[model samples]
Target: MSTPPTSSGPQLRSFASTNRFLTEIASPSSLRPGYVLVGDEIFLYDRCRKAVLSTLVPEDFRDFSLHDLDLSETSIFEALDRAQTPSLMAPFQVLFIRNIKNLYGRGSKKEEFAAIEAYFRSPNPQALILFVADHIRIPTDVRRMDYQDKERFDRIRETLGEWCGTVELARVDENDAVRWIADTAESRSVRFDPDAARELADSLGADMMLISSEFEKLLLYVEGKNRVTLGDVETMVLAAKQRSLYELTDAISAKDRPRALALLHGLLNASDGGEDAAIGHLYMLARTFRQMLIILEKNVRDSRAIWQALWQGFRMPPFAAEDLIRQARRYKSRRELTRALRLVARADLELRSSPVNKVLVLERLVLDLCAEPKSSLYEPSMQFAIEM
Candidate 1:
């Protein structure tokens, strides 16, 4: 699922479930037996995680108090058993249960859910269980949530909602994300220029995590200046990400599979989110392909005409115009670009399915894009062209 690379700006939105969790974490007495963090937004998700850790698990008592369990490896029954049993080493117990989909998988799971109901009814007072359902990606606008995620959310609601508090970690809005950057920068005695913040957010697709990490780098880069400008953002953020991105596109267009994969790994390594940023990478790939499609369709020859051909938000950076135009021209026909987009779309669906080893999924995608199509087939309707 598409998620922000990392969390940004310490402050949460008024409507954020994470904010509510922070408030609730303050009064441990009123805490519920368990909470389900339902979303794949890493920034918001990390905030919730930190709140719980700081409140319940002390650094020294971590070994005794903290438990990171996966239902796939360890059964839910075993997890509840550990929760029910008191820890002599620590005063409180905090369990982070991942791979929660295992519970809702095949079989009626009546025995498992009944055990949950029984445990919650007479839950251990000294323990807290947090179910990380990171598989579901909740969008800023819930109406636009993908069909599969909606179904998963509904199923989880029907089952887990009966006993646990639901904390949705949805994507941050663009305006709010920009505000967060400004607020966070000010906290560190730095002035975040409005244009700079907006450009940074736009360039990275409002990914709070990426925005946050890259802003940190920008802060260090402009240590004495104490002010982040749009120029600094383009130099530090866009040059670092977009430049490498275009290079990756160039390699893919040339069918240089090794170079493309290497560039993909470099992009992933440079990112703080690593494999977690796979969706963001795929989003950019789909976007670049879409741009190439438009350039081809309009027969845009020069970099100057690209401005008129591609719309405002979809336009490539100034430095990448010529490179993008050249890359677009490398494609002999529109079908190739459309085929690339279709591959990206398929990879996107696979990522959303919560596959093991996300990096492998990305690597496979790069390999497919670099591979020549077996048949010179073309869709008359050109359905895949606009599918992205």
Candidate 2:
């Protein structure tokens, strides 16, 4: 539902690509038969999707016209077949193909590549193929993108890029993110203070998804004032600092007791209520550990799989997705994660029991969680234990 950032200002690569896509959407004759949206930066992905959906699929014929095909479940041949076959219910077909990685897995998939090339050679004039290669993460500076992701991206470019328009949906830079906050608020008739934008972007690691979500709340919070300030951001976005909790979980997963404890203390110190917020910290910790449990149980190997494994309400923030997956994999089995969850549950109970020193309760919980469990039994005798 988000619009492309204004082009009057300095354009971030992410927004620039989307703006160009929007431009293409305007001129139907100039539009590519297909486009490879090549990054996991979800905010930009959503923008491109909105553009395509609004321009191509009429609201009345959406059910028949829009196809969300995943390569994980649907084969490339079948998807292409669907594209080739005209829809009787609707005049135009808009197919969104996800899990493009499946085509490049294991074997050479020569048949699949050949099928794609054959289709694109004379693509359906009525059908718009939008392939989502979201498995790759492109930073603001793609030169620094991880080596393996680079390899996959290169392969995608060499293969799909040959026929489809390659759209580089890179991550938004911190400066661009701030500019976006201001411009977005201006479009909404709300004045976003400069300091507020900086603080908001910095605190959330310049994550566009998080930035957009929090920006919505700021708009609602300043409904009548027509202005968003740093104080409003600080008030509305306190719980979102759980990115710090992700850091703590990372340390705990690595069994770095000192770092874990340090992060725990850092979290406590940053809290508005300090000891009184121990329960809140425990709540976030418990939620994160439970999420890790689901990732471990489902064998979520990447950000894309994590989205499928975790539901909307239970999902972690965009910034924490990969970190949580990596942390979840650190455990050899489900028992270790469940044990951590049990520890969190016990700490929650202790916090509720009117303890004299609540910090110590959390500290003890962190220490125990960071230690390697001696029991290999899958089912340990622990109450309030959660399973994915």
Candidate 3:
């Protein structure tokens, strides 16, 4: 995430606002002297770095990948020393530090951090320091300038006062994701109707980098098209696991047992023999169903409310809200929903432990869940028994 270089010059601050980092960095007036970007999203960091450098050195400069830098061998002193170098051609040099979490080690890590603290005491004016601390906590000294807790977003405002500015990088919720898609589509001069963008966002989930790339692809594909439609998104966007899971739900809701079973089998086959990946998919599926069941029990009529509830718990694409509501309507009772979820959980366990035919096992589970009168929920079991 990046903010446009601030006109007031760069402000020393910490970014806590989730995925909107790009929007922040895009601001033409938010760049500062020393920037410590903390997050696990490498793509976000890379994009922010590019954006910032583009503004700082609009013409000529080499792109440096901090990941290539050996943090283990390079001491904090060495890093600062490198940052001290004058720009070969330009007035300023850009230093990109990737995987700042590596700066936190046990033995030598302590020394490195200490050196960093000392270096921060007197930052280089000629060099722009961009520290990418992907998911690692900044030291208290650095954080002291701008701290924000849920109850106190103004903590930074009050504490740092004029000394620094704090930008909170909150996780991109569904609404934000949708808005981002629309904005991105518009900026590319491509038409992204609400439904189409939502579809793409749902398919991409919270992976902004992938979402951005996919949006670009869609923009290119529909170059001359004035506005993108749902059909375009459906044809161009490949569904990620979350969307695929929702597809499975939709198939089950429609009593399309074959389709539901196919979806499950396809997911397993795509697992590449990784038990962890299969388990992770099932875990997400189970959690989604469980939440859907909860929403149904509440008898929530407002689709947006139901979606908001789910988004609070899971990173569902905003476009899937209606589908989830429709699927929720298919479950007449909490008992039936619970039963289906139990079957999913069992299938998850079987996938991990059972020596039996994995494909057959998953197929049976799907069929059972689609059984009518609950046949829609249990038919797979009967089919598996007969086939086996």
Candidate 4:
């Protein structure tokens, strides 16, 4: 006799990518299994949820049928039991259960898991249950972690992987981020320049929630405008915390040592400025130099080729590809980029270990990077006509 099919693992699906399981459920005939959205970013998870809900319930019925359950405080047994009841007022109901710790994870009780597994095997036809995994990633001050903590987190993730169906909402990489910015702007009937979009993405770092928040603000700011520019980004998106760091990078890229040092000092003088600020400055500068180096090393010159290289290599948008190419041309060869990276690395170590002034260490590093081997640091009076 043929062996009975055995369990493999979690049937994980991705929202950004195609999932045959989800495709099969597209028709109204199939049963909708619960979902586990795994991601540190909420924007992707929220987007996945909206799509799922739209497919499950029409917009008109959402107000009456959709309900949210806070499982953190509420007992899992009670929540599951409550979700099992069919809605009298609507034909279908969507029960969104937040904080799924009780259902799965280190602290998840065994009895609850058995009950939940039973529910998954035979769920209510009229109700669609959504168990949102509470693994929202937050900033961790301790960059290095003890092995035990890391193992515990891994265990939690493994436990979450047991769900019948899952949607992993991973963070948007550089290229995807620029694409997202452009797409988001287009959707709102606003014009977003590709270069400007890349600049915005780079400036914002990996915080998609903040990126979306800024996107909304920019959309409203440019309400009647035809296009958003790099200047607009510098004016709005990079105005607050990131202003100094980005300005310093611009100065460094423009080969304006004096301006770059000025911005560095300005940042260091601020109340929040100190070792951290200096380290951040070095890190951003290093990143810029690295991108330029990549462009030069690959011999990628054309905008399309640059975009392809950047997207595949660094996840940068094509629009920003042009700017990087131009900057790369300014440096004669890989040696220049090599020297610059070394300078930053050296500064990082000095600031972390040495008793020297933080500001002085960064200033010296900047000078070394800008100085030509045969000439003094790029002349302060020789200004380039480039806009930051």
Mind giving the per-residue lDDT tens digits that candidate 2 earns over 129-240? 9999999989898788999999999999899999998888898988899888898888878899999998799778898888888888788889998998876776578634
Q: How close is candidate 3 to the true structure, as a TM-score?
A: 0.53
Ranking by lDDT: 2, 1, 4, 3
lDDT by residue (tens digit), candidate 3, 1-388: 3322221111212222422444545554554555655444444455566666565555544543122344556655677787765555566666765545455434555565556556656656666666554443232233443343322334223322123223333334445556666765666566679987777766865555676677667777887875777766665565654677788888987889889888876565545454346656656667667767867987766655875556465645655667787888888887787777767766765776764666676677778778865455444442222221
What are the per-residue Cα lDDT tens digits for candidate 1 across 1-388? 2332223433546236777787787896669889999998887887788878888889999989999999989999999999999999999999999999988889999999999999999999999999999999888889999999999999999988989999998888888888888877887889989988887877777776776778788988999989998767755785557877899999999999999999898888777577888888888888899999999999999977999999888888765888899999999898788888877877787888999889999898899888887465333343433554
TM-scores for the candidates? 0.64, 0.65, 0.53, 0.55
Candidate 4 matches the true fold with a TM-score of 0.55
| Model 4, residue pairs in steric clash | 175-315
Greater lDDT among 1 and 4 belongs to: 1
Model 3: runs farther than 4 Å from truth?
1-31, 63-70, 87-90, 107-114, 137-170, 240-369, 372-388
Clashes (N, CA, C under 3 Å) per candidate: 2, 0, 43, 1
Q: lDDT (CA) for every model shown? A: 0.84, 0.84, 0.59, 0.63
Better of 2 and 4 by TM-score: 2
Query: Tens digit of lDDT per residue, candidate 4, span 159-264?
Result: 5446445554555565666776786677666789987788777777645666677777776677787688765665576433354455565677678998978877
lDDT of 1: 0.84
Off by over 4 Å in 4: 1-26, 29-31, 58-64, 104-108, 136-163, 187-189, 239-388
State residue 29's C-alpha deviation in candidate 4, in Å.
Answer: 4.3
Of candidate 3, the 10-residue stretch with the lowest lDDT total is 4-13
